[model samples]
Target: MHACARVGLDFLDSAPYRIVSTVDLAITPAQLFEVLADENSWPRWATVITKVTWTSPPPRGVGTTRTVTMRGGIAGNEEFLAWDPFERMAFRFNEVSTSSMAAFAEDYRVVPTSRGCHLTWTMALQPANLAGRIGLSLGAPVMNRLFQRFLHNLRRYTDERFSAQ
Candidate 1:
């Protein structure tokens, strides 16, 4: 994997390309966090993700590391920037299999709601070159829809999971 430019929390706010997707889940924030913490749960909800392996041990928190394998064999080495359990979790890729990205990060925020919880997922990226920029720009619309679909998948997965238990 090639090293990606290290990005800070500020990048989530300032990245040139960002997609924010929100969904309301009929589960508490803790339940949502449980899904986030379970590596096996990722592939079940986020279709683009194939696997997740925690590089760091238990008690996940800031600076914890993980490797995520996505579709198309793309892999990312990530480090957590914020881990507030049920409320917020964010991470940035320290390295990636592709050269098209200068940086990439994601922020997941959960807020309690009357129904259950509201999740706002934000994906931020900086393209490495003109080709990358053009590709992202052209694919933005489809990507946005795909992201929202992932959240809907999450909602269904969680609903089935909790109801079964």
Candidate 2:
């Protein structure tokens, strides 16, 4: 894998391309965070993700690392920038299978609501070259919709998961 640019929390706000998706789930923040922390839970909701493996040992916190494999065999080595339990978690890719990404980061924030919890997911990226830039620009809209669908999937998965217990 090629090394990607290291990015900080600020990149979540300043990246050239960003997609923010939100969903209100009928689950508590703790339940949502539990799903986020479970490696097996990823592919259940994020259809594009194939696997997630923790590269760092427990207790997960800032600087923890993981490897995520997506559809099409795209893989990313990620380092957590923030890991406030039950509230916020964010990470950035340190290396990726492809060279088209100069930088990539994602932030997930959960807020308690009257009914359950509301999640805001932000994906930020900087293209490595002109080809990458054009591709992302054209695909941004579709990507946003897909991400939103992932959250909806999460809601359904969690409802079924928790309801069965």
* TM-score, cand. 1: 0.99
- Encode model 1's per-residue lDDT on 1-165: one tens digit a residue: 988888999999999999999999999999999999999999999999999999999899999999999999899999999999899999999999998999999999999999999999999999999999999999999999999999999999999999966
Instruction: Assess the local accuracy of residue 158 in candidate 2 as a C-alpha lDDT between 0 and 100.
Output: 95
Colliding pairs, model 1: none
TM-score of each: 0.99, 0.98
Candidate 1: RMSD to truth = 0.6
**Candidate 2 overall Cα lDDT vs. reference?**
0.96
Q: Residue 40's C-alpha lDDT in candidate 2?
A: 100
Steric clash count of candidate 1: 0
> What RMSD does model 2 have?
0.7
* RMSD list, candidates in order: 0.6, 0.7
Instruction: For model 2, state the Cα shift of residue 74 in Å.
Output: 0.5
Q: Give one digit per residue, the lDDT tens place, for model 2 in 41-71.
A: 9999999999999999999999999999999
Off by over 4 Å in 2: none
lDDT, model 1: 0.97
On the 0 to 100 scale, the lDDT of residue 100 in model 2 is 91
